[model samples]
Target chain A: MSTRRIHAWPVRLTHWLNAFGMFCMISSGWGIYNASPLFAFHFPTWSTLGGWLGGSIAWHLAVMWLLVINALAYLLYGALSRHFARDLLPLSVSAVRRDLFAALRLKLQHRLGHYNAVQRLSYWLVLALGVLVVLSGLAIWKPVQLHGLASLFGGFDIARYVHFFAMAGIAAFIVLHLTLVLLVPSTLPPMITGGRRETSHE
Target chain B: MSERKKAPPKLEPAQQTQVVNLQRRLLLRSGLSLGALAMLGGCNLQDGDQVDKLLWSMSRWNDRVQAWLFSGQRLAQTYTATQITDPFPFNAFYAEYNVPEIDLDGYRLEVSGLVERKQPWTLQALRQLPQRSDITRLICIEGWSAIGQWGGVPLRTFLERIGADTTAKYVGFKCADRYYSYLDMPTALHPQTLLALDFGQVALPPDYGYPLRVRVPTKLGFKNPKHIVELFVSNQNPGGYWEDQGYNGFSGI
Candidate 1:
């Protein structure tokens, strides 16, 4: 049997930072949303981050710096190191279709470090959503200064809806990602421990 | 727990090792859960908490950044008369029924701090200044906005008329309703900043801060104080009502 390192240090570091920062942003965002909800429902107090509206706004703005800087750093590292190209690229509808059926039958291969077609597609989608949410947030935060960005979303009022929906998309991805990790528990330890795959010869 | 403490002293060799492992595992589990709870609880900015202090400092730093980003020459977008929101919403910390009623007979807009002129000006005196009007949106912190037409003396004109120290860093307003707020000097001098006396070509109604209000299209609604009774120029930041509680002090839109 043999083993080798899979996840790199930068990847692990940025991943954890994003996890924590997103938690802060999303929880606090809910608190801010309750102040003037666009929808009929409100998030329960226990599920929110900040205790009140002012406190939530503070938390949201504070975490924004962390989330934005870390996300940028991860993108730079991913591109320079060819991580995205090597692991998550070349996604196609045909491949996704094949993987979907194979996964349903519990026959798809589970490689420790390699991504499947569905994983690649979702990663790309989440990345796009991240960009969307950030831009929408900026537009609304400084509508007068960033009027160009706000106009792209049809104005400040519409930009808010864009931000909310982007958040919802990311949240959906998180749920699916967690469920997959639990099903393939071996994938979890590797993300933390920089993954070592053991290949045995009979 | 008491039973386990007593057993540790008497357990045999194999049993003692098992007991020790059990205790260690329990301690690790509890410790991990406790850490998670603390992290979540720290999300709220508790008064005087270390996390709260750190967040406040970050907010203050952002205020500096936003101030830098603010451009005096840039203007908030203007809308046509038809685009103005009809029956604009009246929002404040208090209910509409609690709007203060000021007698126009004795109403005065007091000026102080760093100004050459100490005398207060009446509503008629304010109206005599060169006036301008704008139909612009007021973006609130609560994620809602409304467009309305405001006509009044340009704040820059008023400040210059009073011989205000142009270099002052802060312009604070004390309102008749006990609501107060302050603006960075640049915002206070912006062309769109108005000492608004008229809403939609009519004198302000009581519900909308009759007689006077500061209409700053460049700031969020809270920074545009209503029914202002006093205006002062100072180097010190007189923290605002919501700002002191936790909202960003700069709060530039």
Candidate 2:
């Protein structure tokens, strides 16, 4: 019942690319926020890694396009995929209850060939947060242009802080999510290739 | 595109596993470390101030690598004139009369703490030094950037004038705003950096760090503390005003 069937290539590709994109966005986003001279590396204006503000901005904007496209595709796929009901969600109420408990306890156990209700919930939460970050980012970046949206967050200055602070929250979540993925590697390949082994090591 | 890997085998081979594991460990360790650093950002770095000192060191290390091995990273590109913005007319922080005007004559930049040289220099004396000037954009951490020309002396040149030693690192700027902005000495002395008096060939604006401000090229605007009062060169980390809040202290722009 939980055997690994082949996954859709688009689904897998979008998942991994989006994951990578978010990681880069957070790392480089905060790096620019620091404004210290510590990160002159990784960035285009630096030697090491993602440290320059301008280049980091460019990279963030570019990958942001990728993330937006991938996220939209994933959302559409989830709505139309045959597995949406059977694998992604077993039932509405019971699944929501179990997911809530898992979230509270921080117990993330990835079920083979199926996203436990908790996994589905966390994934959806991250998606929502990503959207919030982008919207807030635009408000701070071009406040006058996005006056309507920026006003929603109290104004330009406040929007800037909100955008930055929300980034901190998102960065924390990303760290937790990555740790989970590494701890349970059984489920990742499906989103990269066509399908992943249910338990290649197990 | 070339950066993409083959999504590694689910349970990677030993060699591959070691590499990925190492990377994961580094990310978690550094990300959480940065997270913790930020969590305590507004608060004085716990009593030890270990993170502050570490950031000071990291500031130097990163500047060196970024400027050298990663030269492309530090290659400051010029934006088109069309990209430049002259900033909205100042409506924020109207000059409050409640604050007393800083007496520039009485002011002497004090250099003290863990240094071989402890001295002070008057505003006139600071202005007399061989100067550096630049026309560049200042990017704010709050997500805005302003392009303006700035002129003044480099803090590194000042440190050299006073005989700073190999042991010293951070350059702490004391300001009339009663705010402190700290920089690793290397960054303070970088070639493009400046301690400026003019914002685009005129007297500095009252709202825009008047009298003097530290113009660290390629840094976020927060590091540009306006209305400078003094400069201190030492081994310890001199932090920025906002850093005490949950923002990144060593914000490498």
- For all candidates in order, the CA lDDT equals 0.86, 0.60
Best by lDDT: 1
Measured against the true structure, the TM-scores of the candidates, in listed sequence, are 0.89, 0.46
**Tens digit per residue, CA lDDT, model 1, B176-225:** 99888998999999999999999997998887887899999999999999
lDDT tens readout by residue for model 2, A1-202 = 2365657666677767876677657766755565433224333322211333433443455456667778788777878875555556554668779777886787755566666666676666666777788888766553433446867888655666677667667777778777877977755665556665466534
Clashing pairs in 1: none
DockQ of each: 0.29, 0.03
Q: Model 2 over residues B134-238: C-alpha lDDT tens digits?
A: 766565663555666778887667777777763476778887766677876556667666788777657676666777788875555777777787777777666
Candidate 2 iRMS, in Å? 12.3
Off by over 4 Å in 2: A1-4, A7-202, B1-100, B114-117
The runs of at least 3 residues in candidate 1 whose Cα sits more than 4 Å from the true structure, single-residue gaps closed, are A1-4, A198-202, B1-48
